[model samples]
Target: MTDRSAFPRRREALAMLAAAALPSAAHAAERRVATVDWSVLETLLALGAAPVAAPELLQFREVAVEPAVPNTITDLGLRGTVNFELLLLSRPELIYSSSFYVSSEPRLARIAPVERFSIYAPGRPPYEPAAAMMRSIGARLGRSEEAERYIADTEAEFAGLRERLKPHAVRPVIPINLGDTRHFRVFGADSMFGEVLKRLGLANAWTEATSYSAMAPVGIEALARMPDAWIALIPPVPPGALDVLAGSTFWNALPSVRAERVLQLASINPFGGLPAARRFARLLGEALPAERGHG
Candidate 1:
């Protein structure tokens, strides 16, 4: 039992099937694809392809926010928990995924061919892989031209951002996403944020190796050690973490905070590809200059 009674109603949804990823050279129509990975989904959007279906779209909206997910693409559910029965009914021709969900690939492949990509590798920077994925996916989608254009445009944007930041690249940048006031996730050299910061001609404050490019659930005391750094706080701020930080003497007394060197960056897909790199570079471009003398 998978409750076959619901199959007939969902059959109509099959026609609106999402596009596949890294498809074969045949043609776009031959492979009906969907994706459970946000990075893949966003890459599809950036390449101007109609994604078959995307997982955790609502959350993606809050975090990744660029090239924009359309209202037309269906939300399959969270990345870890997808609607397998719905996928089965739709008869997906393929499924685009990433290393983040490798354990789920077998299950996903049961419904359709599963093509997986990885940007985050142990001790390796994700930027290059992300660019390669864009081109590869674009070629598979028969949109290689568009992929090159996007890559060029993203690189040009990064170049412009680097030039814009040159004068004030004064301090090393510490990028973080708050898990709560007491603990947070810091992006290291292998992270998209850290690597992009390097691309933007800025130094990353967290020099140590990280477990898969980030170190999480770490105490605030760690951040206090980077006295001359600019704290780049990535959001969706943990509810009232800011309020909690506002009153605590320990928070206010931190050298970076006391010097007003914190840069509040909008949320980004920390392990993402080109679109995320572009979004992050843009966020830094806007935030850093605005905080110049004020810091």
Candidate 2:
């Protein structure tokens, strides 16, 4: 039989080992992170991780509505000219970015570990890359479970939207960002908006070739070609775009415009991940009933 006195010593030893295995308080406090990409920032927020700093924080607020950023977080400045001085001063434990800013990685690494994530790749589905980025960022931040849950929840949300959109599935929709009265950026099969449309069981009307941005700049005449398709314009529409187009003979001639089959959705981040996809899905669901009546 074991000695009774030795049992107390064994229990004390086990407790000490467990305590040593746990993360120290100081180490836990060092989890602060920063991001240079808005989509990355949004994904981190959705995972319940608040980045200490992010680029273009104000613009992110203007464009992205969900997964809101807190005012306490510092802005790292514009995307094209990130304030490196401010970023270094923040002393983040990690810096998240994308390949578009790969040139700055070496300099950024002087302050913290820099992890680059890509949400757009040649010949790949938009949602796939976005999901991969979410999982990767989540794992790095120790929030893998949250990432998976968010993806699953988003899929469920899309599924519900798909069911609700069944009646209007036959309506081909074209999503565009109206650049001006004369020009617009139309989304194609490779865009995040296109993926959301697919998941919602809606057909995309713009099938033209495009760069990795998955959109092409086209004129108002382009809409005439898609006569049967409804136009879903992303808002904060260029100032006076509607008023200007209203008086133009070209805009009035489109069969869709004549039928009033146009919808103005809330601002959506075309480059965002699961959160953005969910937002687009909900927007489509809300607008479909009206679209059907107009069609």
Candidate topping TM-score: 2
Clashes of each: 3, 0
Score residue 252 of candidate 2 by CA lDDT.
88
Clash pairs of candidate 2?
A: none
* Residue ranges of candidate 2 with Cα displaced over 4 Å: 1-30, 290-294
C-alpha-based local distance difference test score of model 2: 0.83
lDDT score, candidate 1, position 63: 84
Span of 10 residues, lowest total lDDT, candidate 2: 23-32
**lDDT for 32 (candidate 2):** 81
Model 1, residue pairs in steric clash = 18-52, 19-52, 20-33
Q: What does candidate 2's lDDT look like per residue over 121-168, in tens digits?
A: 654558988899998877776677889999999999988888877877
lDDT of 2 at 229: 90
